[model samples]
Target: MQYHYEFILATMAVLGILFLFTFFKTVLPIRRNRMFRWLLVAESVTLIFNVLSTWYNSSFGQVPLIVINTFDVLFFIGFVSRDFLFYCYIESLVQERAPAIRLPRFLVWTVVEVSLLLILTSPWSGIVYSINDSGYHIGRFYRLVLYTNAYSYLLFSIGIVLAAISRNVLARIERFSLIGACLILVVGNIMRMLYPTYLLMDSFYMISILVMYLSFQNPDLYIERKTGLLNQSAALSILQEFGKRETFSVFALVLDDFSENRRLYGVRQMDAGLRIIADYLRTRYPDCFIAYLEEGRFMLIARQVLPVTTMCRDFDRRLQEPWHDIHVSLYLTASYVAFCGPLQVERPDIFLNYVATALRRAEEENQLVVIDEQERQRADHDAKIRAAVDWAITNNTVEVYYQPLYGTKEQRIIGAEALSRIVDPELGMISPGEFIQVAERSGSITQLGEQVFEKVCAFLAHQDAVALGIEKINVNLSPIQCRDERMPERLLAIAGNHHIDLSRFKLEITESALADRNVLQNNMKRLQEQHAVFSLDDFGTGYSNLMRVLRFPFSDVKLDMSFVQAYFSRHNRLLPAIIDGFQSFGVQVTAEGVETREMARELTRLGCSILQGYYFSKPLPEKEFLAYVARTQHDPEHTIRF
Candidate 1:
């Protein structure tokens, strides 16, 4: 019974290189990767023990009986353990993709326990192998153990194929690689049994592992090359594995206004700064899972409570100094949002969205926020609102409500302001302010605006505004809507579809819409060409610049309700002067929030041509608004008294 060692040594060399690559490249502590690494260890150990056992058996006359027994027993244990580890690796891979498909743990462990017990008792009972003074010999149950091992491989291959067929989440190449590994092991065992003198099993194992590595385990998929931190995919993989059951803390550091920074500092310099930040975090928290989420954002995850305050302080302090070698003093502001808990969402994507919302909120409020129950509720609510918005727009459930605007000179309802309203069956009347903000943030504002505009067109076409003494209907536009290059054409097409005149459409825009003056000006000019009118709404809110207002062709400027309320309640002198200046520029001043007749009289005296508030009418559905206009036209005292 002579054994060849050349093929065995060659296989060991290849496996050694493969094991090192797998060990060093696998940075994420994800369950699947960990299982695969353990499988590699088992393979390496089994190969070494097999080589030792082979050498000792060749020198059976010279080597001690105890050493031969020890090496052979260890080799068998390692051999059996390799199959189990491969099974675990496959199970973890499937679980990561489709967590529902779990194999029977009790059945697997039962088989493993029995196999290990038989191997452990083999030296005394000689059930698996025997070492007589003549030579090493296979015992009675050796063939049975080999059959069982081959059966397990066949079972694993079947399981992998079944799981792959049932779940589309597993990649095709991954499924094939896994199934191929099992089949390769089984075939290698059969071939070794046919040719007892040839050492082929270890070589086959090496080939199977190489197949897996080439298919999916490439380090570049998960590592961010520039920053040397795990990339977004790696972060997501770790989160998906532990998000539902594990309690951990996640700290997100997002660059404030990342787009602006990218534009200002250039992409290369910003990337250099990101690398510096990554290095700082990686050095400070060596044990934590650090991921560079790109766009000047990094995520730090830890299983235990972290010194968040100390870490943030040190992070900020380190960032104050200019990036080394880059030499440019890049001042990057970072928003911090931290939370420690089991993510309640069912999927990793939802959890990521919730974290992103928290980060954006932190950036907007300019504060470090620890996400608590209230913040979680807010995130959930925003998610629901986003869903509701999508459903409403998709189902055409978005309704338009009109609030009448009163003409001071005529003392009649001259126009109305179109507002969007969403009434969820469960949530019931979501606030316009809240839903609008959610829609804008979720990038659904343009679609929502289109839906509302189309509905308004339908209302204007069906209802006779001239018959009701209505001159125009004001529709509010968000900054995001105005930035769209096709918004003007979309609005005109909607109005044309309904055979409505564009002149009767006074598109109201908030001061924030002035952020991109060129886009707004271009859209405004295109709309005005078709006889549409423009009005600056929310005049006294953020970034209120009168000179910026004059950049577009604005027919009207509505004083924000805040300014109107301040003027009427606290005698805000600035409001009156601002109104006078806009009026003098030949822009009709429409005072919003004129809730009382006294306030209306004062605003009219202050030369405001149009007054809109609850004093005239709260925003009403199409039927109610039309009826109110008709009633006011017949009863002039209705406007003065009501």
Candidate 2:
């Protein structure tokens, strides 16, 4: 029996030394983690108290034995406090960005401290344990008091896991770790009470601690160190775990105008703002779990659909005041796109992707945009158009369709505007109006514009334009082309390579393009110097300052079809005056969409210099447009609608 006691002591000794070695080896920079620090203190105090109690249990002298038993009870009382501390550690590990479970901290601690006070002062009263002549002996209510307190801590630990799961906060692995740790202690404590003589409870706690160390310690890899929030990978894990069910809403929050802030304050100052943002979310959004996505981006998961009206009000209020916690005073705004789930989304990646798309649209328009059926269809359409445009650009199959710009005075095809048409073998013909927006958004306009210009050059090289009495060929320039610094050189090279005269080319720009007067003037001057003409296209469709646009060196301005058709009956309102003003400035005016010969006769009477519409010819392929030009120029008596 003495040898049995010695063997038990040796086992405790071995375990004690092992814990100390592991502590020193694995706990570097451990002070930074409050959870691990609480855990360390709890385990250390428990290990020391348990070892001393076992050794001094059989000491001979009654005085020493009484003191030892008292000291052991003091340590035993301390274990009750450690139980709550252990629960605190676990709570911190699983808390994520918000409160996981609301245990009344004040009430729980009060009950625990009161229980501890009873156990510590038990020697005098012998309510928990008493020292006697026979040996250290147990009090009558020992197991009841001990277990009741221990079970309270167990209840807390279990509460955290269940709350996290029901809220859809934890991934599968997180659920496994938390549940496994609680089970180990629960089963181990039952065994300890059943076989009191055998020392199994401490070993069970150590095993649970080991499980937790492996589990919670990995958070460093997935958490943002600056703000202590989960990063994208962990956020994605939560989404994957709960995306299919109808448990929660995921929100994508974009920091609007973040680039402007970064430019003004620099990166260090922006980081300070971001940290404050993390803290702010923790307070204001008490029920949401947050993930630190890329810079100026964040993901928030909550138990139900967000009150969009409330959030919008808050958003407005936040922007109305300047916050001072950052490096400088800052006013900010955010775009919130909610992922309405259970019915709309079927998978995590799809939910995140849709949220991203909605957020982008909101940011672009500087407003709140929802991802509904219309938005989804628009996204799918844009994607298809983008893919078809990419394939068209790669294959060099982009075709140029020419609409004849007939000089009404000549009553013949004098020139034509080169419009790009995409005729794909797979998708068939894609309208210019549909794919042009896609090209602009994707920044593929530069490539697509160059290809169209090349196709126009190829067409001119194939046609006998000078022999066919052509004055010029107009090519539409996108806003993206207007901004490109290399536009003049690239266009000149393509025309020169095709041996077409630059004087026979006209570049049509929108009225809005002239808003940037300086750059547009520079590019236009360079092209004008090379003997090319500039025409303002779709003139009255914008806020056309006719005087302001004529001030630029453009030789012609095309009248928008809407104004021409609107004034066919009501001709004296503004159209006649606008056309006279352009012709007086030596700027030729062309009226397009002359669907009726009545519209054409009225525009010709209004002193419009040129006419273009389906009444003369719809936009035609390269070979057919040249044929019409050749046939009309030769047959001077070609029957006019007049």
Task: Please name the candidate that would achieve the greatest TM-score relative to the true structure.
Answer: 1
Q: For residues 1-642, could you state the per-residue lDDT of candidate 2 as single tens digits?
A: 121232344445544654554455433222224555566566566656665675576553534766686667756765776677778777765554234265777866875776787787777777888776676777887887778788888888898778878878777887898899889889977986887766666677767777776665545566877676777756655665454456667666788877666656776777777788788777888777787876587777876888866776786677688656725666678877765656354334445556666777888887777667877776666667788998888898788889988787887778898888887676689988878877886788888888988888877788667787787889888877887778889988888898876787888998757656677888888998899888999987877677788778988889888877777656537888898888888999999889878877888888888899988989999889877877767766664454
lDDT agreement of model 2 with the native: 0.74
TM-score per candidate: 0.70, 0.53
Each candidate's clash count: 0, 0
Q: Write the per-residue lDDT of candidate 1 for residues 1-642, one digit (tens) a residue.
A: 788777887787778787778877555667878887888888888889898998888788898898898999888888888888777877776666666676677877776678889988998999999888888888899978856965774596568657766767666776677778778877888888898787778888888878877776777778898898988778878888767666988888888888777666777887787887788787888878998876677889888887888878877887677676545557877889898888776556667777787888888997888888888788888889899988998899999999999898887889999999999987899999989988987788988988988988888888778888888889888889999999988898899899898998899998877867688889998999899999999888766677778878998998989988987678677877887788778988999998887998888888998999988789999999887887878876564553
Cα deviation of 486, candidate 2, in Å: 1.8
TM-score for candidate 2, please give it: 0.53
